[model samples]
Target: MKLLRVGPAGHERPALLDADGVARDIGGLLGGAEGAGGARDIDGSLLADPDALARIAAADPAGLPALDAGLRIGPPLARIGKIVCIGLNYHDHAIETGAQPPAEPVVFMKAPDTVVGPYDTVLVPRGSTKTDWEVELAVVIGRELRYAASRQEAMAAVAGYAVAHDVSEREFQTERGGQWDKGKNCETFNPLGPWLVTADEVPDPQALSLKLWVNGRLRQDGTTGDQIFPVAEVVRYLSHFMTLYPGDVINTGTPAGVALGQPEPRPYLRAGDVVELTIDGLGRQRQELKPA
Candidate 1:
């Protein structure tokens, strides 16, 4: 099932995308009716509730009211506890950035507040010159997982997947950085999803294709097949260090072709530039850059 949130920012309502490609209101399945006692929004709690999910899966789309096609679609999951990101986890991406593929995954973090709607405007940090784009496959965790004993155990904790734009500010990241988070945690840096495709639907996480275009020109075109640390392994590996909660997210990593990997005067994002990205089966995202 493809789950999503629809409405204005900060007031999105839980919804499900039916087979007809229409967003159907599932607010009643969440808690009670639309507001009397509905779940505040789609979050870990709903992801963790198998019965609730089953109910939604069985819901009749014909009966549920269809949301306005013009309504804003927000990040699929709300109240995300944390965003654990893997850096240079793709072989080609590592080489492009002039770094050797590490034996272990390179981990980083992006604050939850950085997340915005899939089609929302992305801010180019003021005084920034090297803002870049990375299209990454995002994994949404469904259950608590700590010290996962095996890859199977880790995979079981996954609820769904989504397209994530790991927007970056290179100057603040490498040249004057204490850590990558400084460049990663800028507001509106993470435009997450148009929909969350359930894990059961994505039979092979590593087989999906990812592509990003800037100003109508294709910039990054890659695949999860290139990930050095596959989704299951990254989840299992991170479990040893931190507990994975139902609402937490993991950005497995981005492929090669990011602006930072290009030659001199690489096409870094600037105000007025438009970026559009998509991951097979998950969904698509489009954002226009603007000065902060």
Candidate 2:
């Protein structure tokens, strides 16, 4: 099942794409008619429910409006509580950045405000040099958990996954007096969605292919197969410290081929550069870069 939120940013409604590739108005199934019963507010639960998915699969989308032709898609996970990220999780990405594989995962945080729709515009921050792109697989948590007992247990808590672009401004990221947050938290930095594919649909998250293109030129091209700490392990590892709650998103790092990893060092995004990225079976996203 590919779950989505469509329409204007704040007013987007819950929607589902069935197995037959038809769009259904799950907004009603979510809560009730008029989006009542507070079911619409429980999208996370619906995604985790087999019966709910069945209902969506069996739905007759004939009468529904044509999937909101003008709708601007938003991040698949609504009401996100946190945006955690892993750094140097891909072996090739590590080597590209001139760093050794870490003994353990390196974690960081991106401000929730950085969240934007898959096709939204990416702002090249003011005075920014080294703005870069990272195509990552984002894990969406369905249940609240702390101190997860094992990787299998952690895997069970996953709601689904989506394609995420972790756009960074390197100067602010490194030259600033603080941590990577200074560079990673810029507005419109994280563009997620196109769809939130449920975990059941993805039997092996580690085997997926991921790629990114900037202005039609390939930038990042790699696979989740290279992840140092795979999805389940990442969730389990983070749970040992901070609690993973429903709707909290974790970007599982990116593969090699980022602009920063280039030998000559491209410093930033310019107006009109387009970034298109994808993760196998998850979905794809395209965003245009613009000066802030």
The model with the greatest TM-score is: 1
Report the Cα lDDT for residue 221, model 2.
78
RMSD per candidate (Å) reads: 1.8, 2.5
Q: Candidate 1 lDDT, tens digit per residue, 1-292?
A: 9999999988898899998899999987776323323555678887888888999998889999999999999999888999999999999999999999999999999999999999999999998999999999999999999999999999999999999999999999988849998889888999999998899999999999999999999988899999998999999999999999999999989989999999998889999999999999998999999999
Give candidate 1's error at residue 121 in angstroms.
Answer: 0.2
Ten-residue region with minimum lDDT total, candidate 2: 30-39
The models' CA-based lDDT, in order, is: 0.92, 0.83
* Clash count for each candidate, listed in order shown: 0, 5
Evaluated against the true structure, the overall lDDT of model 2 is: 0.83
Error of 1 at 242 (Å): 0.2
